[model samples]
Target: MRTLHIITGLGIGGAEQQLRLMLRHLPTSSSVVTLTNPGPVARGIEADGVPVIHLGMAGNRDLGALPRLTRLVRQGRYDLVHTHLYRACLYGRIAARLAGVRPVIATEHSLGDAQIEGRPLTSGARALYLAGERLGTSTVAVSPSVARRLEEWGVRRSRIHVVPNGIEVARFAFDPAARRAAREQLGLAPDAFVVGGVGRLAVGKRFDRLVRAVAALPDARLLLVGEGDQREELLRTAGECGAADRVLLSGRCEDPPPAGAAPDTLTLPSLLAAMDVFVSTSPDEAFGLAVVEALAAGLPVLYVACPAVDDLPPGSAPGARRIGPSVPELTAALREVRRAGGARLPQPAAVRRYDIAAGARQLMSLYENAVHGTPLPHEVSCS
Candidate 1:
């Protein structure tokens, strides 16, 4: 079936990368429409042979883009419309309706109790979200935690589907060669202990805590992936803590690199390979996708909060440990891990639990249900 996927921007965030990965496995005719910045992920999607259209949406209040979007939807005559992120959901749903396309589905990729998409959750934002939510046929939550948050927000239980965010598990399998190569590229010594975190370098991610924690250890090197406005602040924090030389901020590393990619290309999986341990200091997380990826790489994970792991049954992720949010707690954990040495753990069941192909099938089922007017199923447990 022909489907149109709309998102706020095609940047190097979890939702954007997840969209590209899911499209690789989904067995259907699909195209993408980005309402704003068509960044690196957009190029990656195009390289995957999918057509990507940039709507050139100037801003949130640019109402003129609505007719243009509606016109495009009408012209495409897509069987279903899937929206991701906040701005896309608000506009795509209305555009799909205006074009007489009844099947519209939206995925709530980042929704925390106090924040949505790294921004403070305001009452007005929630009101707008709920209003737009009504126009869609169903809303998919990336984790059981996000599903619970939606329920708490007064969305009908019947309308929410729990489809956790997934990863290309095999791509993240630990590789000795990759580890050596990535470390060489990053100028890290082979025996140097590395502490890694992957996410937008934002305040909500609490990467400052990670920097301070790693700084407390003179030998531990910090390799952070992804970029944001907080880059300067993080570097400043490293300088203040006298760990500036040890911190490496590798900006926006894409994974599952394009076919015929350069041998020296620094993708996410390669970065994960170079790391000794993975840490997620974010006090609140919608799904903790990076933690799952780290688990796939057989890296022991220390996280402050991860609904993806927390919601799972015990022993699902043996290598993943929950730690306190404070910098001292993170510092102590790193010390313990360093003393233990950098041995890759056995690939955990959590990796298999969130494979991208399985998630694609689940999403396809949702699409079929929406297109055929079948009753969308209620939320189910991830395990």
Candidate 2:
């Protein structure tokens, strides 16, 4: 079936990369519309042979964008309209209804208890979200925890469907040669204990806590992937802790280049291979895609909150350990990990449970059911 996907921006964030990865596996025809910045992930999507259209939305209150989007939706003759991110969901849902599209789906990618897309939620924001939510056929939550959060926010549980975020497990398979090359490339000594964290450097992510924790360990080197508003702040924190030389803020890591393309820089998987351990200090996360990816890479992980692992049965992810959010707690945990030494663990069963191919299949079923006016399932099993 023909589908039209709408999103706020196409940057190198988890949700943006997840969209590109999902399109790669789904068998149906699809196109993308980004409301603003058509950044690197957009380029990757286009390279993957999907048509991407950039909607020049000036800002949140741009009324002109409404008619423009409605017209585009009508002209595309799309069988289904799916949206990602908050702004896109708010606008795309209204536009789809205006265009007479009965089947509209929106994936709530980053919904926390008090924040949506890293912005604090106000009453107006909640009202707007609920108004738009009513126009869609179903709202897909990236995790069961997010679904529960939606229910607590007054959304009908019947309209919330759990479809956890997924990953390409094989792409993250640990490689010894890649590990050696990536270490040399990053100027890391072969025997250095590398501690890695991947996510936007935002306040809510609590990367400052990670910086402090790693700084306390003299022998540990911190490798932080992804950029955000907190770059300068994190560097300053590292400097204050006397670990300025130990922290490496590698800017955004792009997806793997298309097949046969000459590799220009280190891919995410290559960077993962260079790491000895992966740590996520974020106390709040919707699905914790980064933690799952670390598991796929066979890196021992320490996270504060990860619904992807927490919702599953015990032992699903043997390498992952939950810790408190305090700096001292993180410091103590790192000490224990260091005492045990660095050894790559086996890829756990949890990694396979969130396979991208499986999620795509489950999503395809939801699309068919929505278009045919069938009752949506409460949860689409990714495992």
Candidate 3:
């Protein structure tokens, strides 16, 4: 059956990463449709030789764009439609239904509680999503917390499926030689303890909190990766915390760290390897992809105990330490992780729960159920 996967943008983010993994493992005939203009991820999909159609929808609620999207899905004769993120989920699912696809599936990637800066669609949007979800065949939640929120917002518990985000364990496998090479390439001293955090520079992510924590610790360097609307604000905050020099703001690195003592772009795997400890200070993360990436690299993770981190398997990695939701607690945890020698890097086997291949298999099954009208045997009861 031909499947059409839809997302808002091709920007490098968690939802985008998950969609890429799903497309990679799915059958060759599957196609990708982007509601907004494609970005970096579009190139990756194109490289895989998958057909991508861009609808060129400018604003979030572009009513006029819906008919064209619906027509494309209809003409393509897609059997299934899978959507990610807010705008794509709403418009894509509705268009899929109009196009008469057998199963319309959506993956909930955000907490649904936090509000976007310029886009303000709260109760009305929630109601719209609820109605669309009821009409669609199935819904996938990236974490249990997101599933709970959907239920609280009035989506039927029976229709929702909890499939946690996954990563390629082998891709993130620990590499000692790569770590050394990355340190040298980045000009990091051999004796310096490096703490790395990856994500958009947003207020909700609380990267400023990390800067504060890093500033309190002596002789520790921080690596802040990724780009966003909040970059300048975060930079100013880092300067205020007196960590401007010690913190390396490597913006938008597509490649992993170099192997064998070369300073190359920090790939997700290499960045995890080059770090003595990985820290996530985000106040609300639907699922911590960067945290799981660190775990897959056998690096210890210091995450704030939010609903997102609760899904992390208990005792799976020695470095998975939870800190209270305070700057002081986070600061202490970073110091302790450094002092404790970063808890002997974890084995890739420990992170099998988040493995992308496994996640792909589970998602495929969900799609099958959506198409065949059969209930998933191990379905998670949302209520």
lDDT per residue for candidate 1 within 1-383, as digits (tens), equals: 99999999998889999999999999989999999999888999999999999999999999999999999999998999999999999999999999999999999999998999888998899999999999998899999899999999878888888888999888889999999999999999999999999999888899999999999999899999989999999999999999999999999787667667887898888899999999999998899999999999999999999999999999999999999999999999999999988479988988899998888878887988889855444433221
Model 3, CA-based lDDT: 0.76
Compared to the true structure, candidate 3 yields what TM-score?
A: 0.91
Clashing pairs in 2: none
Q: Lowest summed-lDDT stretch of 10 residues in model 1?
A: 374-383
Worst 10 residues of 2 by lDDT: 374-383
Q: Report the C-alpha lDDT of model 3 over 1-383, residue by residue, as the tens digit.
A: 78888888876666775677667777537888888868777766776677778888989867998999899899888878888887888888889888888588888887545643224448787787787777677788888887877788888888788888877678887888788878887878877889899988777788888887888887889988888888888778778888888888878754322123234556777766778888888766677778878877888788874444575466555557777768798788888777778344656444776777777767777877777765555634341
lDDT, model 2:
0.91
* Segments of candidate 2 deviating more than 4 angstroms: 258-261, 374-383
Worst 10 residues of 3 by lDDT: 254-263
Query: Candidate 1 overall Cα lDDT vs. reference?
Result: 0.92
RMSD of 3: 3.1
Tell me the TM-score of each prediction against the true structure.
0.97, 0.97, 0.91
Which model is ahead, 2 or 3, in terms of lDDT?
2
| Candidate models: Cα lDDT each | 0.92, 0.91, 0.76
